[model samples]
Target: MFFLIWLVLFLVVVSFLLLLPASWHRAIYERYSGGRPVACPENQQPAVVSIDVRHAAVAVMDGRPNLRLSDCTRWPERSKCNQECLSQAIQAEPYKPGEVKAGRKQIYHLPVLLAAFAAWYVGAIWHSHYMFREQWLQAVGLTHAQVKQIVWWLSPHLLTAGVCLLFAYGVAWLLAVSHRKGVLQGVLMSVLLCGALIATTWFGIARLPHDLFLIEAGYIALASLTVGALVGGLYDRLVLPSQ
Candidate 1:
């Protein structure tokens, strides 16, 4: 059941990262709604051109924002001409929201690994006897002996570490795709992903005890923030500069 819940949360995080940015990019690109003026490459004639913003936004996730002409003033007559004018349109507005630059596409492994370890450590502490372990055990109605009795090829801690690692990777991927850097950007993205996890938790409110829900939700929130800050901020200030 726990693994199932984690799997669902992972899917939710991925969906949020992918869909949100595409929607945002589409909105930002709406500035080109009426079309922009560009010089036709073939005849050097001035013409109005419309861009396929939706495709561009979706393409941004793949590290390149595709620029294609949906309609042009020279269309029907010269529509088949290569979109050499795309260069001019790009020059007019060089930056697009969520557009990942070639240099920023490389994923820094150190920060992601560190963030995962940190998140897993935080989870360990959160559920330790020194902290809320007693309350959590009570909330879940599980005794330490009962927990020890469970048999599996992988220990629960190992599974948690694995999940944390995957989650950090997901966060890093989103940051890379969006061309976002700095601690603030990392924290913001992490918080958004954490919110998605919390939403899934909320759906089980009726099936779970209130205390258990609170404990699980709180831990997830803290772990997410830790992962985000480390991957986002640490990578920008420390690891990225060294690379």
Candidate 2:
């Protein structure tokens, strides 16, 4: 009943969110390249393309054709009749005009997301369970009912869900970073995101927590966003073109 309805709603939200990026890419490709000749603005020269031979494996797997230079002053093959076609093709080269694809290589993120989600949840639940059942039960400090009440009121499950969403956002942001990689980028992004979260909170949107616990939760969300951005930046370095 209640659980079933919750599951259904979660599934619906996830499905729609998952489809959004792919649909966005599709719309972008559809609009510009509707079989018309791609025009380079007067100031813009034709493209000069190159690939990294060091990462040849990735390049090969990424399967778009090599771009042909329109000005065949470089290539031995040329014709007066075919210069425009050659020029058009040079523009087309490895990637078709207006058809921007993600990458030849794939590092699946679902497993990473799932693993992080599981690890965080497990840690949080174990902490709550031990606090309520074993630790609090043995201590003269808190009665069993009191321990249960604390855990129930704090709602570890809701906190975990919030952390998970933060994780998702962090990973997505990491893959979207414009520059930098590895620890440097991670550290910087963490700093920026945490700062943003804290600074934004000061604007007086949500009720400020007077307690240490929720202050930590807010920090955790901030950390998650930073980590997510780091992951995303690294992935972009590997999978997307560097700007």
Candidate 3:
């Protein structure tokens, strides 16, 4: 499995998600006997319409108003997000009519996404190291054992990428949903949110052993944000009849 393979898989997953009918997310959660549309609370629904809402939310809430420099380097013993930010989060978009409103918009689905990212990381890291090992071996390479060690070394980027995904979508929703922001605004918000995520994690995270891995993560953040933002803005622009 090469990085290209992993990247293709990532794109494929997203593409399949797109084909499943625009309302598939709501349908997946609806799972009720009644076929009638259900009303979701503002929180239970996606704050925005994009496919990547989960990522936006995590990126938005990655830090506190007063978190210390030290905390950035250390992973908290447990997850805690209640009132993590001083400012009131912009409200999520209104639930579609007839949808029951949940108390809070699920702006981000953290646990589910973490699981997904971890899976991707393992796959990508395995692919990257396997290739590295093969080249290293053919050239004058290291042992299989050494290859495994290299895999372990690159693990931090995987974890950091996952962390960055945490809040990326929540941010998109904050602007596009709660604030009813225009496409450009939503895209800009998402870009800034992602930029903040890369900066905070790269600077604050402890034990990032590989500098190239760090560079790759930074580049990935930029790439992912650009993709996410352009997708959103373009989607919005295409909606106009004039366009």
Candidates, ranked, lDDT = 1, 2, 3
Query: Candidate 1 lDDT (Cα, whole model)?
Result: 0.75
Tens-digit lDDT track for model 1 on 2-106?
999999999999999999876778674764443566878787876766687766766665566776877665553465688988877755643344433223344
Best by TM-score: 1
Q: Model 3, 106-216: lDDT tens per residue?
A: 232333244235435544553464434354344443577875676678676667666545544555455434433334554566667667765788665545445445545
Against the correct fold, how does model 2 do in TM-score? 0.36
Instruction: Report each candidate's C-alpha RMSD, comma-separated, in the order given.
Output: 20.2, 21.6, 22.1
Per-residue lDDT, model 1, residue 59, is 67
TM-scores, each model vs. reference: 0.54, 0.36, 0.30
Q: Rank the candidates by TM-score, best first.
A: 1, 2, 3
lDDT of 2 by residue, 162-232 (tens): 66656545544543433234455545655566567658786663454344335345546644544554454
- Pitting candidate 1 against candidate 2, the one with the higher lDDT is 1
Task: Let me know the TM-score candidate 1 reaches against the reference structure.
Answer: 0.54
Displacement of the residue 205 alpha carbon in candidate 2, Å? 9.6
